[model samples]
Target: MYSIFGVAWFSDPRKLFALVRQRLNLGGVFVFSQPPGSLGAYGLQGMYKGGFAGPAMYTYRFSYTHAMWRSLLLSAGLRRSRDLLHEAPKPDHIGTSDCPSRVPE
Candidate 1:
């Protein structure tokens, strides 16, 4: 499974991750790209409802620190294979997590 600029929009990450865990085949991987927490907030109050340089709409975006991501993934029974932040070209670029479907007891 792969997500690009989408995970942040999830209203309930636990449910989203539970689904991901259920659907992932053994040895499968889940990769996602999101803005790092260091970049700060995106939407107003973590959400926005109105015109956004275009038509009127509602948007939700959540940011988390690397440590927080680790905790969340583990809680969802996903193991981090690697953190791709160091490989990113720019400092403010997206952070990527490569998680495998193996959970420890």
Candidate 2:
């Protein structure tokens, strides 16, 4: 099993997905936590205050919709597995999902 905690915000998820897929065995699990889709809908702005974000916050934080997440996983040969997935309900809480392809190794 492989897990990515709260680090996606500052890294390229596509590259990470490819790396994870290459490393995981059949039936192995992959998990990650990220900001909710709603945040993307609102245009990722004002996440920080008092000039803490400086001029390049976009390079440090990122957000995407649920559909986009599914697409990214699919492109990396992963399928969502409810049994291995969990998501928080709070509006400000980061959402999480898991993927595990059913095809034989």
Q: TM-score, each model?
A: 0.68, 0.58
lDDT of 1 by residue, 1-105 (tens): 778767634545666777777788766787777655545643223455654677657665656667766677778888877776535676745545443334332
Give residue 77's error in model 2 in angstroms: 0.8
- State how far residue 58 of model 1 sits from its true place (Å): 1.7
Compared with the true structure, model 2 gives a TM-score of 0.58
| Segments of candidate 1 deviating more than 4 angstroms | 8-11, 38-45, 49-51, 86-105
Q: Residues 32-88, candidate 2: write the lDDT tens digits.
A: 654455543622333452365566442444456666766777787777664344666
For candidate 1, the lDDT comes to: 0.63
- Number of residue pairs clashing in candidate 2, backbone atoms closer than 3 angstroms, sequence gap of 3 or more or interchain: 0
Clash totals in order: 0, 0
Model 2 has an lDDT value of 0.57
